[model samples]
Target chain A: MAQWALAVDLGGTKIEAALVDAAGAVLPGSRFRLPTGGGSSSAELEAGARAVIGAAYAALPPGESLLGVGIGSAGPIDVHRGLVSPLNLPAWRDFPLRALAEEVVPATPVVLRIDGEAIALAEQWVGAARGSDNLLGMVVSTGIGGGLILGGRALAGPTGNAGHIGHVEVGGMNVPCLCGGTGCVEAVASGPATTAWARAQGWAGSTGEDLAASYAAGDAIARAAVQRSGTAVGQAIASATALLDLELVAIGGGFSRVSPDLFGFIREAIARRSPFPFVAKVRVVPSGLSDEGPLIGAAALIHRADYRSEV
Target chain B: MAQWALAVDLGGTKIEAALVDAAGAVLPGSRFRLPTGGGSSSAELEAGARAVIGAAYAALPPGESLLGVGIGSAGPIDVHRGLVSPLNLPAWRDFPLRALAEEVVPATPVVLRIDGEAIALAEQWVGAARGSDNLLGMVVSTGIGGGLILGGRALAGPTGNAGHIGHVEVGGMNVPCLCGGTGCVEAVASGPATTAWARAQGWAGSTGEDLAASYAAGDAIARAAVQRSGTAVGQAIASATALLDLELVAIGGGFSRVSPDLFGFIREAIARRSPFPFVAKVRVVPSGLSDEGPLIGAAALIHRADYRSEV
Candidate 1:
C-alpha cells in the first residue's frame, strides 16, 4: 500500500483537502473542498476543516497508514508556534491551526507553511523547478503572492514570511495596500485590485473573467487595464530579478491566465527596463502545476528533506 | 613568520593595496594607493596597479611567502573574462586585468570578484555578519552598489552580478541611471547623485562634505535632500529585506557619514513603510571594517573556501 499524507490548502474563500503521496500525486476520489464565509467564526472554520479532512481520510486506500499532515495557509504565520494571522481572515488572527488540527488526529505531526511557499516548494520538487537551484514561485490570483526556493531549499525566514513579494514597491501611483504600504505590487496588479481600478475608470467590468472577455472583444479600456497590471508586475519583477539574480519565476494562480499577451508583455518590459543582461534572461514562466500547486508544495515541505538546510 | 596575501581593491578614482592575513587584518605600513585618471589607457592603469602592488609587497615583512592575490574591482565585471566595464572607468572596458596583474606577480593564483561582493564576504567572514546567515553589504559612495550573502553564501550569479542593488527601483523623481534604468536607487541616492540633485535644486553645495556642513548649519533644502536619499534607501532596503529575509545591512562608503541623523530617519522610514513586521526589524549599521572593507573582503574571496562557492 502506498504511504499517504493529508494536504490542506487554505485560502480566503475555500479550503481544499487531498490525500497525496510522497511524489505529490493525489489519490483518485480523495479530493474535497469546503466553502468559507467572511462572517464565519474560528470555530466554524475549524469545523469546516475537520469535515473536509474526514472526507479525504474516508477515501484513503485501505490499510494505508497516515504519515502526517501538511497545511498551506494565507499568512503572516509563525511556523514555530503554528499560528497564523492572515489579513483576509481577520477572525483567524493568531489562529493556532496546527494544534486545532492535531485535536482531531492525535499524535500525528502537522507541518504548516505559507500558501505561497507551498507553491514554490512544489514547483522545486516535481514541477517547473525540478533541477533548479534557485527559483521563485509567483501566484497572481485574487492577490499577488510568492514563494522562494534558493540553493534547492525552501526559504522560510524566522517568521515564515520570507517570500512575501506582494508588498514590494513597484513604480506606480500610490495605491494603499491591505498591508498598509502604498504602491505595492499587490495593490497595483492583483486581480481584484486591477478590476476595481478598471471599474473606477468607467470600464463596465466587475470580475477578472469579464475584463478578459472584454479585452478579447477589443474593448480599449479593458485592454489598457490588463496592460497596466502587466506593466507594474513586469517592472516589479525586473527589480526582483536584479536583486536576487533569480534563475526562474514560475507564475501560477487565476489572474495570470487573463491573457498570454500579459506574460509576453512582462518579458518585454523586463528586457527593456532591466539594466543587467543576466537579470533580463531570468525566465518567467507558468507553473506546470496549476490547481494542485499549493497542495503538492505543502506535501513537498515534508518530503523534501534536503530543503531543511535552508531553514 | 605570518602568512600574507596581496589584496587589491580597484575603485574608479583610486586603487588600494594591502597585505591582508588569513584573518583579514592589515599590517602597519603595508597599505598603498594608486590614483586613477580618465585619460589613462588600460595599459597605464595596469602599470599603476603593478606599482602599488609592488609597493605593498616591498612594505611587507621580509621572508614571508605570498599565498595568492585577490582583486576586487568596481563592477559590471565579467569574472569569466577577468574583464571590467565599470561606468566610472569607461576606457577600461573589457580590460584583461587578471592577465596584466598575473604578469606583475607571476604564477601566483589570482582571484577576482566585484568590490561589493568582496565587502559582503569580508563582513560575513569576520565582521558584522559573522554569525548571520543572510546579509546585504551596501556601499553609499559615489554610487550606491551592494552585495548579497544569502543562506551563508555570497550570491554571485551566472554573470557575477547578483547583488546590484543600485539598480533596484525605489522611487526617485525622473532621473536616468548610468545602468539605463529609471528611478534606480543609484540615480537618486548615490553620494555624487545626491549632491548633484541638491545643487540642481538650487542648494549651494558642490560636494557631500559641503552638503554635510550645510545640513549642520540648518539648511532645510540640504537636510531635505539628505533625508530624501535616506528615505529612498530605507524604503528600498525594506523591500529587499522582505524579498530575501535579510538579517542585517552593513552600510559603508563616504556618503554614509553625511549625518548620524540620516540613519535615524532611515530607521523610521523602514518601520513606517515595511508591510511585514519581520522586514522592519532588519538592522542597518555602519561597516566594521571601515575604509578597509573592500580590501579585506576582496582577500576573503581567496582565503575563505566557502566564499568561493559563489563563483
Candidate 2:
C-alpha cells in the first residue's frame, strides 16, 4: 500500500492542503486551498481549514495508509504551544492550528512547524539544494524568511523560530521595518520594500513585477533598487554564514527573480568576506521549487520527520 | 579507580596540559605547561607538546586508567586532518598537532577541535551556561572567538568551524579588521582593539587594566570606548541569536571584565532588538569559569565528547 501524509499549509493569504506520498510526490488532484486574509473572521478561518484538510484527505488513495498530518504555518508560531500568529493575518493570533488539524483527523498524529523550516526541508528533499545536508532555505517575497538544515537535521530552536532571518538586521542598512526594528533585511530587501525604495528614487514602479519590467527595459533606478536589495541580502547571508558556517543558501520568491543579476549582487556582498574562507565558500542560488513550494514544504514536515528535533 | 583523560591546549604563546577526571574535575597537581611563542622553532614546539603531555600523564595516579587524549588548539584548525595553523603562531602552518599528541600518548585515541568549540563545551558542562544545551561560549580578549552547542550537541560545521562569531559584522559599525572585513566584532571589541580605539580617541590607557582603571575613575574617553565595544558585541550577539535562536551566551576573557557595567552595555545593545523577543530574551553573563577556562575546555573535548558531532 502507498504511504502518504496529509500536508497542510496556513499563510496570511490562504490555507492549503495536499496528499504527499512517501516519495515526496503530491497526489494528482489532491491539492486544495481557500483564500484568507487579515480581514477573515475566526469562524471563516476554521471553516476554510476544515474544507482544505478534508478535501485533501478525502483524495487519498483507497488503499494508501495515512502516516500523519503535517502543518506548516507562517510565524510567529509557537511549535511548543502548537499555535500560529502570522504577521499578515491579524485575525489568527496564537490560533490553535495544531489542535484544529488534530480535530479534523482523529486518531492520527499531527506535527506543526514554521513554514520556513518546511521549505528548507522540501528544498533539501527535492529542490535546488537537493541532498545538501547543511543549507539555508529562504523566501524573499512580501517578507523575507528562512529555515536551516544543519548536519542533515532541522534546527527548530526553543520556540520553533530558529530561522527568522528577515528580522536579522543587515550591517550598514538603515531601513525601518513595521516590526519596530531598524535595518532588518526584510525592511530593505523584501519585494514591497525594494519596490518602495525604487519608487522613492523616482523609478515610479508600484509592484515587484512592474519593477522587473522596468529593470528589463534598462531603467537605472530599478537596477539600483534591485542591486541594493540584493546587496543587503548578501550581506545578511554573509553574516549568517560567518556565525553558522553554512554551506549554501537557496533563495526563492518574487523579488529574487526581479533581475538576473540579483544573485550576482548577493555574491558580491558575500565576496567582501573573502578573508574568511568559510563565509566566502558558502554558495547562494535560486530556490529550485515553484509556487508549489509551500505545499511541498508542508509535506516535508512529515516526509522529513527524521530530520526534525523535538521542541 | 577514577577514570581520567589527558587534556591538551595549544595556543600562540603557550602549550598546556592536564588530567581531567570523568567528573569534569582537573586532578590536583596534574596540570603542566611550557611556553612556545611565535618565534619558537619547529623543534621547540614539538618538544613543548611532548613535555606537556608527558608531564600531565606522569601526574596520573598509579592505578587509574586513562580514557584518551583530547586537544584544543588555536584555529584555523582542520580537525578532520588533525592540523592547526594559529594566525599568531608563524612557526606552525597547518602543523600536525594532533599526530604529536597521539605520539606522546601512544595507546589512547585522540580527539582534536578548535579551542573556541572546546570552551563552549566546557561552559555547558560546568560553567555559567551549565546544562543549558543551546548556547554560545565566547572569549573577548586579545581576540574574540566562540563556539556553539545546539540541541544539546556541539555544532561543528563542516571543517570544524561552526561558531566563528567574531567576524559577524555589527549593523552600522565601520571598524576594519585585519581579516579584511569591516566592523567585525573582534576588530571593534577585542581587548587590544578597544584599548586602541580609546588611545586613538586621545585616552591615555595602554591596557585593558589601564582602561578599567580609567572607567572606574570616570574618564569619558575610556567610558565611550568600552560602551562602543560593548554595543558592537551586543549587536553581533543579537544577530547571532536571531539566526540560531540560542538560549544563553556565556562570555569570558580579560576584556569581558574590563568594567562592572560592561555587561550592562552589552545588554543595552541587545535591548535595541526588543521587538525580537527570541533575540532579546537571550541571556548574556560572565564566564562561570576562570583563567583555567581554556584547560578545562580542552579537557571537555574528552569529558563532553558526546556533545560533539564528527567533522
Candidate 3:
C-alpha cells in the first residue's frame, strides 16, 4: 500500500491542507484552503484549520495508510511547544497549531516546521535544488523568507527558526523593518517594499504589478527601485553564501517575477560585492516548483527522513 | 589496546602534529611542531610536516593502534582535490597537504578540514560548547576566523569552508580586506586591523598587547579602538545569529583577550544593533579549551563521527 501524509501550510492570508503521497504529489481533489487574514481570531483559525484538514482527510484513498501530518506555518514557530506566533497574525499568538492538527488525525505523528524550511525541502526534493547537498530556497513576495538545506538536511535551529534570512541587516541602508530590525533585506527587497520605494521615488506605481509594468516600459525610476531591491537581496545572499558555503539559491514568489533581469541584477551585485571566490561562485536560480510547493514541502517533513522536525 | 588518531594542525606561522586518544586528550610527549611562515616554501612545508608526523609516530605507545589521520589547515582549502591555498602562505597555493599527510601514514583513512572547523569541533566535543548542539567557534586573532557546529554536526560545506565568518561585511565600514572584499569583520576587528586603526588615530600602540595596556591605563583612543573592534565582532555575530539561530558563540584567540570587557562590548553591541529578539538572545562566551584546542579539533575529525570529512 502506498504511504500518504496530511500536509498543512499556514500563512498570514490563508491556511491550506492537502493529502500528499510518498512521491510528493498532492492527491487530486484533496487540496483545500480557507481565508485567514490578520483579523482572524484564535477560534476562527482553529475552525479554519480543522475544516481544511477535514476536507483533505475525507479525500484520502481507502487503502493508503496515513503516515503522519506535516505542518509548515509562517514563523517564528516554537516547534518544541507545538505553537505558532507568526508575525502577521496578531490574534493567533502562541496558537497550538500542532495539537489542533493532531486532534484531526488522532494517534498519528504530527510535525511542525517553518514555511521557509518546507519550501526548501520541496525544492531540494523535486525542484531546482535537486541533487544539491547545500542549497537555499527563498520567497520574495510581500515579505522575504528563506530556508536552508545543508549537508543534505534541513537546518532547523534550536527554535526551529534557522533560515530567517529576511531579518539579516543589509549594509549601508538603515531603514527600519517590520521585524523591529533596521536595514533588513525584507525591508528593501520584498515586493511591497520595492513598490513602496518606487512610489517614494516619484514613480506613480502603487503596486508591484504597476512597478513591473513601469519597469517593462523602461522607466528609469522603476529600474532603479528594482535594482536597489535586487542589490539588497544579493548582498544578503553573499553574506549567507560566505557563511554557509551554499551551492545554489532558488528564488520564488511574486516580486521575483517583476523582471527577468532582476536575477541578473542580483547575480551582478553578488559577484561585485562578495570578496571570497566560493561565495561569488554560488549560483542563483528561480524555484522550479509551482504553487503546490508549500504543500509538497510540508509533506516532506514526514516523507523525507532528513527534513523531519526535531520536536 | 587504546585507539588513537594522528592530528595535524597547520597555521600561518607553524605546523604541529600529535597523537590524540578517543577522549579528546592529546598524548603527552607526542606533540611536535615546526615553524612555517610566509617565507616557507612548499618543499619546506612538506619536510616540516613529515618531521612532525615522524616524531609523533615515534612516540606512539607499544599497544596503541593509529586509527587514521586528521589534518586541519589554514584555508581556503580545496578538500575535493586535497589541496590548500592558504592566503598567508603564497608558496602553498594548491599545495596537497592531505596527500602529503597520507604519504606519512599510508592506507589510513585521512580527513581534512579548515583550521576554524577543527576549533569548532574541539569546542563542541569538550570545550566551552560541550552541551550545546548548535554553536559557533571563533578566533579573533591577527585575522578573524570561525567555525560552526549545527544540528549536532560540524558544518563543513561542499568545500569544507562553511564558517568563513571573517569575510562577512560589517555594514558601516568601507575598509578593504586582504581577501579582496571591503567592510569585512576581519578588516575591522582583526588584531592587526585594530592596531592599525589605533596607530592611525595617533595612539602609539604597536601591538594588540600595547593597546590592551593602554586601555588598562584608561587611554581614550585605545579604549575606542578596542570597543570598535568588539562592536564590529558583535555586529557580525548578531547577523550570523540572525541567520543561523545559533545557541552560543565561543570566542578565542589572542586579541579577544586584549580586554576583559571585550565580550561585554560584543554582547552590548549585539543587543543594541540586533532588531530581532532571537538574535539578541544568543549567548557569547569564551572558549573553554586551552591552547590544545586546534589539535583536539583536528583529532575530532577522526574521533567524532559527526565531524568526519566527506573526502
Q: Which candidate is the best by TM-score?
A: 2
Q: Per TM-score, what order, best first?
A: 2, 3, 1
Q: lDDT at A146 for candidate 2?
A: 90
Chain A alone, TM-score per model: 0.94, 0.98, 0.97
Model 2 per-residue lDDT tens digits across residues B81-167: 999888778788889988888887888989998888889988888899987988999999989999999888898888777788888
For residue A60, what is the lDDT in candidate 3?
Answer: 82
Better TM-score candidate (1, 3)? 3
Q: A95-130 in candidate 1: lDDT tens per residue? A: 888887787667777888888888888888778877
Clashing pairs in 3: none
Evaluate residue B246 in candidate 2 and report its C-alpha lDDT on the 0 to 100 scale: 89
Better of 1 and 2 by DockQ: 2
What TM-score, over all chains together, does every model reach?
0.92, 0.96, 0.95
Candidate models: Cα lDDT each: 0.80, 0.86, 0.87
lDDT of 1 at A252: 83
User: Can you write out model 2's per-residue Cα lDDT over A187-262, one digit (the tens) per residue?
Assistant: 8899999998988888876999999999899999998998999888988888788777899899998788888899
Look at candidate 2 and tell me the lDDT of residue B77: 78
Instruction: Write one digit per residue (lDDT tens) for candidate 3, span B1-311.
Output: 78999999999999999999999988999999999999988898889989998789788899779988988889888988889888788899888888888887877888889998899988888899988888999999989998988878788789878898997766666777665555678889999999999999999979888999999999999999999999889878887887889999999999999998899889987887444667778899998889999999999998996654443
- On the 0 to 100 scale, the lDDT of residue B307 in model 2 is 90
Instruction: TM-score for candidate 1, please give it.
Output: 0.92
